[model samples]
Every structure is written in C-alpha cells, then in structure tokens.
Target: MGTKIGVIGGSGVYEIDGLQDAAWVDIDSPFGAPSDQILTGRLGGVEMAFLPRHGRGHVHSPSTVPYRANIDALKRLGVTDVISVSACGSFREEMAPGDFVIVDQFIDRTFAREKSFFGTGLVAHVSVAHPTCPRLSQACLEAARAEGIKVHDGGTYLAMEGPQFSSMAESKLYRDAWGCDVIGMTNMPEAKLAREAELCYASVAMITDYDSWHPDHGAVDISDIIATLTGNADKARALVARLPALLGPERAPCPHGCDRALEHAILTAPEKRDPAMIEKLSAVAGRVLG
Candidate 1:
C-alpha cells in the first residue's frame, strides 16, 4: 500500500479526476460532521482521500466550513499528508489569475472559528509558527513545475473572516501594510488544527483576482472570481494528479518539524489532565500521551 494523502478541495474544485475505485465515506468526528462525506480512492497507486472544503453543493460559507471536523475526519481516515487547494485574491502584481502559489506562511485575520483541538477537558498547545510542511511544499512545487504550470515557490497568505469580500480599505491595508502575497477566507483553523493533529499540511493557492487594492482593476467581484476560478480548477486537478509521483511511494518525516509539533506542548500535569478531554482527544493526541 502507498502513503495515504488527503486533498481538501476549495472554490471551483469539487472533485478530482482519475481516482480509481472512488467511494464516499461519511466519518463522524468528535468535533462533528465534516463539511461533507470524504471520497476515498487511489491516485497513482497511492491511497487518497478527498474532502470538499465548501461541502458537496457549495453550501457552507468560509466562516461556516466546519474546519475542526474536516481536519479530524481526515485524521480518522489515516491521512498522513493534507494538500489544501484554496481560491485567493492576489496581493502582489506578479501573482495574477491562472497562476499557482505554494504558500509557506500565513497571517490569520479570522476570529469566529474554533482553531484548536485541545479544548474543554484536554489542553495541548502545539507550535504553529511554521505551519505548512516543507517536505510537502517541495513536493507540490516540483509537481507544479513538472506540469508546466506558472507557480511561485513560497509566499504569505492572509486568512480573513469573511462571508463578505474585504472592503477596499481593508484590502489596501492587507496588501500594503501587511505585505501579504494573497488573501482568502478560509485555511486558518484548518491549518492550525492539522498541526495539532500532527498531520502534514500544505496549501496550493490559485489566484482569481487582484482584490480591491490593484489600481488598474475594479473592486473585487464575485462573478469575475467565479469565472477565473473555473479555469484554474482544471489546472489544480492536473497538479494534484502529478503529486503522488513526485512525492514518491513511501512517506518520509517532515523536514520542517510539522509532524513533531506536540512533542512537548502539553502543559497540563499528567495528574491534572482532564480525563474527559483526554478521551475526546484519544484519536489525535494518543501518541503524545503514550
């Protein structure tokens, strides 16, 4: 068997092609139901699980994506690595529509979501300063290059809390003051939770617009974004299909230390650790306790 990989689809990417024996599996997590049922199958002979970030019919808003459940569900399904494909607006002049960015850093402006797994009874604080796995990022970069796609190796992504697009003032601030490369609504709590679960995480950002900050472009529009996203979706699928071959047949430890983040993070004394919380986190933090 090959290493298990999980792909989180965003925006226009609802499904992946070339997945053999694809079957939808609804997994119940301690957090709750994931955005939707996960589809499991083989891609390039590797075991792959795909979860639509916005739900099957695109029902959930960015703020309502059930991120905790999505991460937990992927963990429960034995997902060792996760590739999040998100649609974003460019903050830089060079990152235009139809291009791909492998984000290495993030600036989270989101507030209303549950961003951690250690709550209630269990309390574990995992390090997230460097979020995405460098190993996986390298693989994604190589895959993108091999596919002849316009790709940027690394950049900072700004994650905002939004059912609404950012205002012109806000967009300008993020682009100028924040020095971010791209902006999007989701990818925060999901990336943080994946770290807490010790799962490798990386994001493939597909630029759809220049946001509201670009002087030459008009204000951010949903209709225009959708059209650009539809075209990028096909490219995203092609990039994913090439990842397994680039990553190889077996798994290797993350060079960036993403998988070992919780090594000493649990602050609660062994005797003080909440039994109820421990039970709830059994699936995710069991190795730490063991």
Candidate 2:
C-alpha cells in the first residue's frame, strides 16, 4: 500500500467512486466506533481511506459524530494526510453557492464536544494558531482547479454548534463582524482532534447556501441547502479524484508543521505519565514517545 490518505466525507458525500479493491473495514478506536465502517482502497495507485462523517445513511447529527473516534481510527489506519470534505454556507458575497474553498484558518464556536485527547491523567496543549497544513491545503486547491472546479485558495471557516442553521443575527455577526468566509457545523473538534493525532489536515468547504445574511436569500433554507449539497457532493468527488494525482505517489513531511504538532505537547514527566494513557495514546503519539 502507498501512503494512506484519509478522506472524511460530509453530508451527501457518502460514497466515492473509482476506488479499486475497495473493502469496508470496521475500525475500533479507543474513543468508540467511527461514524461508519472505514472504506479502504486504492485510487490512482495510491492508498486511500474513506469515512463518511454522518454515517452511511446520514444518521448522525452534527453534534453526535464521533470526532475523536474518527480521528483516532484514521491514525490507527496509518493515515498521514486527512482531507475533510464539508458542506458550508458562504459568509462572503464572492463565495457563492457551488464554489469551493480550501479552509486555511478556523474559528471554533463548538460548545459540546471533547476537543482534545490530552487531559485527565495526561496534560498537553498543542498550538492551533495556524491549524490547517498549508501544503495539504495547496494540494487540495490545485486538485480542485485541475478538476475544473472553481476554488478559492484560502479562507477562515467558522465552525458553529449546529444541526440548526444560524440565526440571522448570528450569521450577520459572523460575516460582517468576524469576517469569516464560510460557516458550518462539524469542523471544530474534528480539526482539533486531527492536530492531536498528528495528521496533516485540510478541509474542502463546499458552499451550499448563503446562511441568513444575504438579503436576497431568506433565512437559511434546509431544502435549498440540501439541493445545493447534492451538487457540491458531486464536485467534492471530482476534486477528490484528482487528489492522489496532485499529491503524487510518495509522501513528504508537512512543510507547514502539521505532522509534528505534538512534538513538545506532551508535558507529563516520563515517570509520571500514566501507563493507561500512554497505551491509549501510543497509536497516535508513538513517534513522539520514541
């Protein structure tokens, strides 16, 4: 197998075509079962792992997806690069429906989730000031462009706690005051957890609606969002199809420092480190300990 690239498909992106030798692999992480059984296969001669964030039938809610379990499963599968494909509402006028954005920054507004792996017996704080791996983001942008999709190079994604769409006031605040490019649910703890797992993370934001900020559009419509999500899902698949080609057959260390995020993050003294915690973290932090 080649370098493992993990792809987490968001709403409406439950399947990826053209993966040869595909087989469903049920992964058990210390956190719990992943959103769904991981699909492992090869694309363009490169090994890839696909996991549907919302489960196969879109059963999980935004707040319910096991973010920690998902990341841990990817890590256990030896995933070096993770690409999160998410449907988002545009916060900017230029980022219209059907457009794609490679999110480079994030403002996490998630309220209910365990966003870290180092706590309790272990104490570690990884810097998330610059979260997304630039190299990976660049590759995703290039892949989208090469696939003939309209792609924005960089943007800040505001991850809100929601199965519900943002209110007009909240949407306007995020757009006008905070200056976010996109808004979505589910990217929070996912992004944070990816860092803790030492995986190079990149998100491809598929614009599905205009939230409630656009005067021309009424309050975010679930029906319209769902319709747009279908189209965006197709685009997401096209973009993913070109990823292996863009990334090439070999793997390179992340130029943006994403792969070594936990280098100095483990603060517990070696003798004081909890054996159980170390055992649990070994799957993700073995290199750091070694």
Candidate 3:
C-alpha cells in the first residue's frame, strides 16, 4: 500500500498553512455517511484525507459520531493509515492542558456504539492488545515535537461513553485506580473498527482540561474545554503539516501487523458467512473475505 494518510480529526486540524489541492469530498459508506465530506489534498507530497470527526460545525456527539462509517470510508478512500486526533481531559497533572499525548493504549468504556465491522453473520476477532501502530505513532510524536507542541510519546487513554462529562467519582477512579493518563469521549469504536478494517491506527489525544480530578483546576467543563481547544486546534494543525514530511510519500507494511489483522482472525467458515455481510465487508475485510 502507498502512504496515503487519512486523518480523522476535528474541523480545525485539516487546514494547515501549506496544504495543496485541499477539497472536501463526500463519501457514502455502507455503514452510513461519514461525519462529513472528507477534505482530500496533498501535504508534503503525500496524499492526505482529512475527515472532520464531529462534522463541520461539530454536530455529532461522541456516541453518535458514526465511527463505523468513518473508518469504512477511509478504508475505501485507499487510506493505508488512519490517525485520530481528539480533545481529551487530563487525568495526570503533568500531562496538563494543551499537551499532546500519543496514546499507546485504550480502555474503551463505550458500550452503546457498534465496535466492529463484523457481526453475527460474519464473525472475526482481531487482536487489540497493542492497538496503536508504533511506527505511525512515532511519526505523529515526531511531527508534534517538530512543531514545538508539547508532545508526550506514550500514554493510556480511557475512552468513556458520553455526551455527559465524567462525574467526580468516575474521574477519580479512572485517574487514581485505573491509571488512565487521559480521558476522552471518542476513540473507542473508532480505534477498534480501524483494526478490523486493517488500517494502521495512531491516536493523538490533545488535552483540553483536567477532568474533574484536579482539586486546583476543579471539574472539567465544556466551556473551558472549548476555550482550550482554540489553542489546541492551532497546535494540531501545525502537527498535521509536519506528519507528511516525516512519514514520506511511500510506506512499508506495518511492522506490527495492523495492515493484515484479518489474515487469520476470521473464524466463520466462508460458506457459513452471510452474503449480505460479506458484501458490506468488501472495503474493510476484502483482503481476507476474498
């Protein structure tokens, strides 16, 4: 596969200073319409696809962001790698607001969303023990650092089910007991589905506030987070520009096997698999479904 980079991020991250030939192109997926038209362009001579995670004006909430459609669309766009950038609340003081964390792990507490492309008719289990692609993440980390963004190379992200912010008790538990470094409302089904789609995935969590756990910072509030996102947005855009230069215009197979997750994961016999489900899996599991 070529080094076509797909970035699923908020509206502001896509408009870097020197993006060439940028255009938002619509993609209708079997899963559904993606969050918005994907902004397709070239940066650093690499093909880039940028989808606004929350739609153009930030319409969708966390649970309803159409995670499946977004990943499926990116896969269909011929994106060899997917990078997710989302606003998060910090659990650790050191991480702080405005820091960018290259999330290495996830504890997905989101239960209401469709977490995979395969289901009852077509079953598959892909390993997510080490979810994020290390090589891709290193590129992201390097990109952020080169832009003078405060980048933490690794951290554990706790993905919560929410349109609601975490309660104080929940925040404390995630911070003190679970050892979560940052908390976000998205990145759950998003990351999991990417693995099932066999796309190299990397998550960069931009801290917007301290989630209810900091006594000094107090509880995480949407207003503060929004204000923080203004700066985060600028930092994120700068970070995005640096990626294409670092990742280059061609790529090697993911050293971690993210590009071929379904080689042996599908346990359902081909004869037993539903034709309808197989048709829907054309873009995602095509390499194996054939």
Candidate 4:
C-alpha cells in the first residue's frame, strides 16, 4: 500500500490547500464520532487526510476533543503518518511567537480525557520513552525549513488540560522548574492514543504567545494569540504542502519501530482477553490481537 498522510489542524487552522479531488468524508469510529468529518484527497499524488481538531467553527474546547475517536478514525482511514499542527505558548525567547517546534517529547498533565484504547477487559502497554516518531519529525523539520519558516528541530511539549490559559505561577513553574519548551492544551492523549494505534505521529507546535511567565507579555491576551495564529496558520499550510514530496508516495516499515509498537506490547493472553474489548480494539490493535 502507498503512504497515506493525515494532518490534524489546530487553532486558526481549519483546512489545508493543494489537494486534488478533496472530499469531506464521514468516518464513524467505534470509539465515537470524530471531531469532524475528515477531509480526504490526494496531494502531490500522495493520499492525504485532514481533520480539524477543534472541528469547523471551533466548536470544541481543548479538553472536549475526542482524542480516542480521532486516532481511531485516522487509523481506520489507513493513515500511516499523523501530523498534528497546534498553537502553543513558548517558554524560550528564541522560540518566539510565529516559530514552529517539532515536538519530540511530552509531559502529559491532562487528567480528564480517555488516554487509551486498552482497559480492564484487555491490557496493553506501548513504549513511549521517545514519543514522536523521529523519521516523520525530521520530514516536518525539513519541510518547514524549505518553506522559510523558522522551525526548531525538537522540543518538549507540556500538555495541560485547559480551556483557560495558565496562571503566572503555573506558567513559571512549567517553564523554569520543569524545563518545558512549549505548552499547549491538546496533544496529550492524542499523541498517546496515536502510539496505542501503532501510527507514526509527529507534532508541529506553532508558537502564538510567550505565556504568562514573560514579564513583558504579562498575561495571555486572546487578541494577541489570534493575530499570531493567523500568520502561523498560513506558514503551517505551506510546510504541509511540501511534505508529500519529501515523504514520497510510497513507504517502508518505520525504521524507528513506530509501525510495530504492538509487537510485544500486549499483555493479555489470547484466551483471557475479553471478546468485547478485543472487538473494540480490532481497528487499533488488530495486527497483534489477531
């Protein structure tokens, strides 16, 4: 099978360009309804799928995104590579507003969302020691550079559960004490769920503000974030448009082991696994489960 790329658009980014035969297709996932109908088509002869993380018109909050269903829906659509483009607040001045960071690690502080596909009935544990897929992330970094976008090669993303921006104290702690590079509300369970689905996931964090830690910036202003997001969104689309050629229309097994994450990750013995849970996991874990 050829490579099928999936792009998850975040705040201020509702869609992408340069797709041929683009169509919004409704994909029903067993987990639940995805954030929105997926936009699928071909870009530079490579299959592509786009999903708005917040849905069209920005209907869902950060905490309300259907993380599990989103990953399942992409997996169901045969997306071999998943690219998440989200807006974030930077901790360092060098990673200023309008910059892009290819996040390679995550500190998941989100508590309310469903973070996994396996549970009581069936059990599995996938290694996330190095969260983002290196090969895919490198492709993102190169694409951004090719587009003349100031993009950092790697950084750690702190995923917080929020509809509200962080307090001064919280922002300072995450920036100084924890050494986080960029902070965002999405990407937690979304990245985790992608691993559980055995998909090669890469995160492209677009910097919008300096958070509340910067003395000059004071607090996160909606007006400021909106302005930066608007500019960053345009650059993000250009970077995405360059991906198909770099990644090519065909793919081999992931050299970093992203494609075979479930190889030795399942713990439940075949006989002991629940039939219902196994059925539910069919799409995400079918390779190892079968």
Candidate 5:
C-alpha cells in the first residue's frame, strides 16, 4: 500500500484545505466514535486523512477527546503516519508565540482517560521510550521551515490533563524543574495509543502563549491565546500541505520500529486471551493477533 498521512488537528484548526475528492468519513471503531468524522482525500497526489482532535464546533474538551477511537479509526483507514498539530504554551523564551516545535519527547501527566488499547483480556506493552517517529518528525520540521515558520527541531512536551490552563506553580514546575519545552492538554494518550496501534506518529506543538511562567507574560489570557492560535493554525495548514510532497505517495518500514511496536509487546497467550477483547482489538492489533 502507498503512504497515507493522517493529520489530527487541535485548538483553532478545524479543517484542512486543498484536498482533492475530500469527504468527511464516519469510521467505526470498537473503542467508540472518534472526536468527529475524519476528513479523507488526496493532497499533492498522496492520500491524506484529517481528524479534528476536538469535534467540529469545538465540542469535545481536551480531556474528553476519544483518543482510542481516533487512533483506531486512522489505523483502520490504513493511515501509515499520524501527525498531531496542537496549540501549546511555551516553557522556553526562544519558543515564543507563533513558533512551531517538532516534539520528540513527552512527559505524560494526564489522568482520567483511557490510556491503552490492551487491558486484562488482551495484555500488551509497547515501548514508548522514544514515542514520536523520527522520520515523520523530520518531515514536519522541513515542512514548517518551507512554510517560513519559526520551527524548533526538537523539544520535550509536558502533557497535562486539562480543560483548564496551568497554575503559576504548576507552570513553573514544568518549565523550571522538569525542563519541558512546551505544555499542552491533548497528545498524551493519543501518542501512547498510536504506538500501540503500530502507526508512526509525530507531534507539532504550536506555541500560543507563555503559560503563567514568564514574568512579563503574567498569566495565560484566553484572548491572547485565541489570537495567537488563529495565526498558528494558518501556518499549520501550510506546513501540512507541504508534507505529502516531501513524504511522497510511497511507504517504507519505520527505521525506528514504530510500525513493529507490537512485535513482542503482547504478553497473553493465544488461548489465554479473551475472545471478546481480541475481536475488539482486531483493527489495532490484527497483524500481531493474526
């Protein structure tokens, strides 16, 4: 099969433009309904799928996004690469508002959400030591540069569970103590589930504000964030538009083993696994299960 790129849009980004034969596809997944219908079509002669992390009209909150179903839906559609474009607050002065960071590491501090596709019935563990696919991330970096976006090549993202912005103390902890480069709400379980689904994933964090850490910036203001978010969204679209041309309509095995994550991850014996659970995981774990 040829390469099919999936773009998960967040915050101000609701849809992508310039897709040929674009259609909003309702893909069913055992996990649940995805955040919204996925928009699938061709861009630059390469298959592309775009899913709004929050449903259209911004219905779903960051914590409420159906991470499992979103990943499963894309995998079922044969999406080989998943690129997450999300709005974030920068921890570093250099990664200021309107900048884009190609995130390579994550510190998942999120809770109150389903974080895996495997559980008691189907026990499995995938190594996420290096979660984002390097190859895919490099493409994002190049695309952003080509769009004249001030892009940072690598950064550690601190994913917090939130419908609320971070407190001053919390922001300080993540920036000063944790050495995190950016902070965002979505992207934790989403990144984790992508690894489990054996789909290569990359994250592009668009900086909107300095999260209560900068003395001059003070607290995060909704008005300011929304304003920056609007500009960032436009650049994000341009960056995504350039991806298909760089990645081309061809697929290759992930050198970093993102596509083979479940090779030795499943621990349950064939007979020991629950039949119902196995059936539910068919789309996500079909290769290993078969």
Candidate 6:
C-alpha cells in the first residue's frame, strides 16, 4: 500500500543508520532461494528491505547468483522499488575507485543464466529499451551526492559473465570501442528480471578499479578491490540512508509504466496457459494474469 524500498547490495547496507525494527526474514520464492534472507525494517519513515546480493560470507559467484529468485522474493515481500548496488571497474579516467555511477543502460554479454521469468508454458516479452527506471535513478544520484560521495549521474554498464577479471584487450575494447562507463559481472539478468517483475529499478555502480585497460594500472587484483570495497560499502550505506526520505511512504503508478510492464507482454492465452505456470506466477503477475 505504501512505497516499499528494496536495497540489494553487500552486507554493509544492513548496518545503515536510522533503521527501526530490523529482522531477517526467510521468504519462499517460486523461482528458488534468494541470495540470502532479506533484512526487513523501516527507514526514514518508510518500509525498507535490504538483501545481500552475494549472500552472507560471499558464497555465490557472479554467474551463480539467483537473479530471478532475488527479484521475485523482493516482489513477494511487497517491495515496489529496487536499487541494485554493484562493485564495478571504471572505463573512464575520471570515474575512479570509490566513485559511484548511476547506471542508465546496459550491454549484456552474459550467456549462462536464466534472464527472464517467462518461458515454456508461460511466454512473455518485456521491453528493456530503457533498462532502468529514470525517476528512481535520479533519486539515487541525489542520495549519493548528499552522502558526499563522488557519483556520476549517468553511465552505461557492460555486464559480463565472469568470476574472472577482464583481459587488457577485452577491457580496452569495452572502454574504447563499445564505450562502456563501467563493467561488472552482475546486473544483466538482474535488471532484465526486475523489468519483467514490473518493479521500478535503478542501479548504483561502485567503481573499484580501472579494469585492465588503464596503462598505468596492470590487471585487477582482488586484494586491491577488497580494500576499496571497505570504503565503497560505507558510502553505499550513507546513500541508502537518504533514499526513504526522498521516495516517501506512499506509492504512485510509475510514470514510466514500469509497474504496468505486463499490460500487453504476456503472450500465452488464458485458456491455453499452464495451470502450474500460472500458479507459479500468481504473485509476480497476479495483477494482469489472474
């Protein structure tokens, strides 16, 4: 009934100040287990949910992240807006480590994951023409600025399938050829799935390296990234604290129609639709399918 904010990031966001009545709730998802138990609470006079993208102790790899389950779990818990905070490698010279980028677009090169909720018995297609919610992105940009973090208002994120960092050639191609602002292993299917779930979504990419393209910096090192994450995580927490106040405690139909994504997207006729599949979608597409 009210504006429910879902923050998906690292474990640090759970410690954000001003959260009241925090509790870790395990939710059952039609897709499967989410990355971890969702931490639910109230912040800035609005309901809030924080999910650790990689699960506690950093168990899941990039390709292995349960993107569908994560999105569905948030939707099941009544989260209306989703904000994904990811650690990324910067392509631009000025977007250095510790900086944040409010990502507007994505170039997905990931091939080894289920990128959608509709398939087989339940067929559907949703436009990702503009992958993220612009209104939500603006709020994130303001939040990061208010936290005193260096945040770029717009960026294009290149999503790669990886547990491996990019090679110099691949990195250069993304920066110089494809013109990507940041590169990360996640965010492709995650963003796509959010659109399908009809949730307003935004992304905040935390720059942690120059990738392998910068002549001055060699290949990326996990140790350096780990150190940078310690700082970025703090800024992420500060940014999260600013969200609820800006978004408020009431809901509005997304001006961009993100909430109505399924209005004409589902292809399967009601009579021909699979009862099992439709039942599975009861929560995700109840507004349109039922």
Tens-place lDDT per residue, model 4, 1-290, is 68999999999899989899999999988899999999999999999999999999999999999989999999999999999999999999899999999999999999999999999979899999999999999999999999999999899999999988899999999999999999999999998899989999999999999999998889999999999999999999999999999999989999999989999988988889999998888889998888
RMSD of each predicted structure: 1.2, 1.1, 1.2, 0.6, 0.6, 1.1
Give per-candidate clash totals: 0, 0, 0, 0, 0, 0
Count of clashing pairs, candidate 2:
0
For model 1 the local lDDT of residue 57 reads: 85
Residue 178 in model 6: lDDT: 98
Lowest lDDT sum, 10 consecutive residues, model 2, at 281-290
**Best-fitting candidate, scored by lDDT:** 5
Report the Cα lDDT for residue 194, model 1.
93
Model 1, residue 206: C-alpha shift (Å): 0.4
Candidate 5 residue 64 Cα shift, in angstroms, is 0.7
Worst 10 residues of 1 by lDDT: 119-128
Worst 10 residues of 6 by lDDT: 10-19
Candidates' C-alpha lDDT: 0.89, 0.90, 0.89, 0.94, 0.95, 0.91
Error of 4 at 218 (Å): 0.5
Q: Sort by lDDT, best first.
A: 5, 4, 6, 2, 1, 3
Error of 4 at 276 (Å): 1.0
Q: Candidate 6 at residue 40, lDDT?
A: 93
Clashes of 6: 0
User: Which of 2 and 5 is the better model by TM-score?
Assistant: 5
Question: Mind giving the per-residue lDDT tens digits that candidate 2 earns over 63-85?
Answer: 99999999999999989999999
Candidate 3 runs further than 4 Å off: 11-17
Residue 63 in model 4: shift from native, Å? 0.8
- Which run of 10 residues does model 4 get worst, by summed lDDT? 281-290
Clashing residue pairs found in predicted model 6: none
